[model samples]
Target: MKRISSIFCVALIGCLLQGCEKKIDLELKTTTPIIVVDGRVTNSSSEGSVVALSYTKTVKSDNSIVPLTGATVTIQEGNGTVYSLPEVSNGVYRNASLTGIVGKTYHLTVVANGQTLTSSSTMPTMVAFDSLVAEDFPGFGKTIKVVTPFYNDPPGYGNQYNLSIIKNGKLIKDVFAYDDLFIDGKKATFPLIYSRKADEFKKGDLIEVVMNCIDHANYKYWFSFSQSSTGSPQAVPDNPISNINGRAIGVFGAVTFQKRSIVIQ
Candidate 1:
């Protein structure tokens, strides 16, 4: 697996921007094909377990990314409840009824293109999101408005978090992971800074903030992604630390999330 791991170190532009457009140029000297696995299960009743499978693009490939099809995907609960996810489209598998439960662990298994990949994650209890406070920060010779969320961290060590900002229903493209290294069981607040200056919200815009209580493995994945997304030309890009065990690249996360919204003033 170590030899396979070194051949597919992807310098991801920004994992935070799931819906944003990106262009990657690979200069690696390898001919081995890679399988990418991305799976997630959330606590929301309206959400479901979604796993997307795809092949890594190479310099010899065309502009479009190729998806891996006809794969078997299954998720098992710690209590031995197994749910099969059917392919809904090209390479995406989903089971809408499989809502994640807090404190329960989940195992993901995927068999595709002659490779077997698996991972496990436990959903953490949600931390209450109290309020969204908008404030101004002096930067680049001007005052920039930003939204900060206030929450009380639960009284336990190793509480990690993944935050997402949505403006007028569209997701913001930036990394927002947090940990209780300094403020465990205490009041916590931080501004949701935008990577691009034009992404800042204006007055009258509707803003929604989501906080996902995640395990340490998922937290490290997001934190590593945040580091690799520096947008610096001089920085050599590498793949984020994945929880999945196999000859694959990506993550499988079981998370419980809470959300709050506010209208920019």
Candidate 2:
């Protein structure tokens, strides 16, 4: 009798659960497209300055980017000299003669789609890279190899930096931003952490690192963008802080950088 009672109860519960089963379709809100500007000026004569324009993507639309072309782009030095960046390709403007100078400020002006946008950034002094050392670190049931860079943070506050990694001649698409909040005016060893089992370092692998000394505004933009991209718990689902104003979302960074390469042994 107890077995029969249990079977009946189980049948009754199944019927109740089937009655409660329902499908839910979520209606996500779509956002309007906005202008996105990516511009950079570096303190290297061998490299040219570039400003690329594009339209933002919406969830319902295709993920392909729509480039903004035929717009006026110019970079003006603090000394009142302006260099018009000619369009080398669609939606991309470049000025080969405009190299950033440390301690000098640069202003970017863009007129696109009948909207004007402008922003300014100052180039900070270059910090010397002392050495690059590759070390093995213990990982989850495996050994991980990473490159550690040694440098001295200059005295005073507000020193910001961005490091880009190039592995085997291909740029790693990650942002590594550092600030001198804890180790101000002190020697420090910061490790470059890029964990990919498929892209792990092997014998004779070449790794190049570019350490850029950027200003405070640029640091905030990069740090915020990194946090959002990594899906941090504290990150808000919004665009990163932009220095550019007037209907555009992006950053203009004047950076002084140094590059160094190391081979994994």
Candidate 3:
């Protein structure tokens, strides 16, 4: 009798567990497409200002963007001088005549599909670096060499910086930005952090460090964009706020570029 009771209890429990299982199908939400505009005007005359236009894609779709063509792009200075940017390639526009000038504000306007978008940015003064040094630093379980650039923060508040590292003429994708909030009016040094050992400088590798003195808006965009890109648990991932007006998603940057190069010794 005890064995029969135990067998009945086991059967009852198995039937209850089987009854509780169900499959759930969730409905995914879709959104309308938003226009994306990425354009920049730099102080370098040789490297002209360029703009690329595209639209957002759905989450379920393949991650390919459709490049927009036949759009009219123009840039204007604060003094009302306008330069038209011609389409060089599909969805890409360039204006070699629109060289960025320090302390001058630049305005960008784009007309596409009967919609207009606009943005403005001011080119900040260039901050000169003192020197670039490659020094040996203690790493995890070993010593490694890193490249650092030394510069004095200009004697003012609200100064922002963006740094880029190029190895053998290719730009690294690491995003580096700094603000003079705490280190105002002080000499600062920054380390170029690379992810892989293969990216580290060799004895004779040519490295170029390009620094841009950007405005506050540009600094905010880069800082927020980097945080969203890192996939951090603490970060609230969202699109970086666009400097452009209208329902567009992108930035119009006017930056001053200064570069320093060094061969690893």
Judging by lDDT, tell me the better candidate of 1 and 3. 1
Candidate 1 has which clashing residue pairs, if any? none
Question: Tens-digit lDDT track for model 3 on 134-193?
Answer: 988766456777789899988877677877788989876566767775567888776766
Clashes of 1: 0
Candidate 2's C-alpha runs over 4 A off are: 1-28, 59-64, 230-237
Candidate 3 colliding pairs: none
Q: Write one digit per residue (lDDT tens) for candidate 1, span 1-265.
A: 2112212222232354333312233455545556666788888877778998877653233323468899999999896899999999998999999999898999999988678888999998888888888889765467878899998998877687888888899877676777776667889877877767767778999999888888877776666556664332112224556677777666788998678888888
In model 1, the runs with Cα more than 4 Å from the true position are 1-33, 58-65, 230-237
Ranking by TM-score: 2, 1, 3
Clashing pairs in model 2? none
* 66-178 per-residue lDDT for model 2 (tens digits): 77889999999996899999999988899988898888899999998788999888899888988888999866468878888889998886677888778999877566777
lDDT of 3 at 23: 17
- TM-score of every candidate: 0.80, 0.80, 0.77
Taken over the whole model, the C-alpha lDDT of each candidate is 0.73, 0.73, 0.72
Q: Where does model 3 exceed 4 Å of error?
A: 1-32, 58-66, 138-142, 196-198, 230-237
> Which structure is stronger by TM-score: 2 or 3?
2
Any idea what lDDT model 3 has? 0.72
